[model samples]
Target: MRCETIREALSARIDGELEPIAPGALDRHMATCAECRSWYRRASSLHRTLAAQPEPPVPDLAADILRHLPPDAPLSSAS
Candidate 1:
């Protein structure tokens, strides 16, 4: 794959949001491409750091979503 394609997919690839790529395509490209490799490394580190973080507790998640519905909802402090 080209470096442009790899650059576009890097974040989703690091997040594991994308379908698996042909295995060696990524390895071969990254081996020769310094910029893409550096970007992937940074993105991978960020993904790891975010994944390692403790998830924030969201009490009554459904209620929170419903309560924030537009039009009829009372203004939230954020507004």
Candidate 2:
């Protein structure tokens, strides 16, 4: 696979959402492409870090509060 194509599909590849052929192509490219292998390592690290974070607890009133907010209003207290 071309480097551009592999780069484009990297995220989906890491997420296990790529088509079988795409991943196989990416893997083949990665085997011989240093740049792509570096990129894959970085992407994999980020994916693992994000996946490791605990899911935030959902507030019972969150939906009700969001429903009443103006469409253009800022959502955070700092805003």
Candidate 3:
């Protein structure tokens, strides 16, 4: 399997999405490919670190956005 294909599969697996390639296939490829093994480890570690962080609070902007909007005009009657 190509390294690109294996890398894509690795990312999908990390994201909990269904992997297109068989798990065994990926394992075999990574076993022989040192670069892929290193990439997978770094990607997995980054994913775990990011996932563990708490999301910052998002301020409600609806009211502020609506306040700057122009008022609606009545539609003219059509013949």
Candidate 4:
């Protein structure tokens, strides 16, 4: 796969969203591509760190905060 294609799918790869074939291809590309490898390393580190953390207790204002957010605002996919 091309570098651009692999980069576009990087988030999915980090999230374990890619199918077996695509992930294998992405892993091979990362092995050979320094830039992509670095990106993968960073993303993998973040995934591990986040995974290690316990979910925070929900605040009483959580629903209020969500209610105040603009409906049209783009939500981040990371959550």
Which candidate leads the pack in lDDT?
3
The C-alpha RMSD in Å for every predicted model, in order, reads 7.8, 8.5, 5.8, 9.3
TM-score per candidate? 0.59, 0.62, 0.74, 0.54
10-76: candidate 3 lDDT, tens digit per residue = 9999999999999999999998999999999999999999999999999999788777767773344
Deviating ranges (above 4 Å) for candidate 2 = 62-79
Instruction: Give the distance in Å from residue 78's predicted Cα in candidate 2 to where it truly belongs.
Output: 40
Q: Spell out the clash pairs found in candidate 3.
A: none
lDDT of 4 by residue, 8-55 (tens): 788776776854346678778888999988877788898899999999
List the candidate numbers ranked by TM-score, top first. 3, 2, 1, 4
- Candidate 3 achieves a global lDDT of 0.93
Each model's lDDT: 0.76, 0.81, 0.93, 0.79
Misplaced by over 4 Å in model 3 are 62-79
1 against 4, candidate with superior lDDT = 4
- Kindly report the root-mean-square deviation of model 2 from the true structure over all alpha carbons: 8.5
Q: Count clashing pairs, candidate 2.
A: 0
User: lDDT per residue, candidate 1, 21-56, as tens digits?
Assistant: 654777778789999989888888887898999999
Better of 1 and 2 by TM-score: 2
Per-residue lDDT of 12 in model 3: 99
Comparing 1 and 3 on TM-score, the stronger one: 3
Which pairs in model 1 have colliding backbones? none
Clashing pairs in 2: none
Residue 5 miss distance in model 3 (angstroms): 0.6
State how far residue 34 of model 4 sits from its true place (Å): 0.5
- Best-to-worst lDDT order: 3, 2, 4, 1
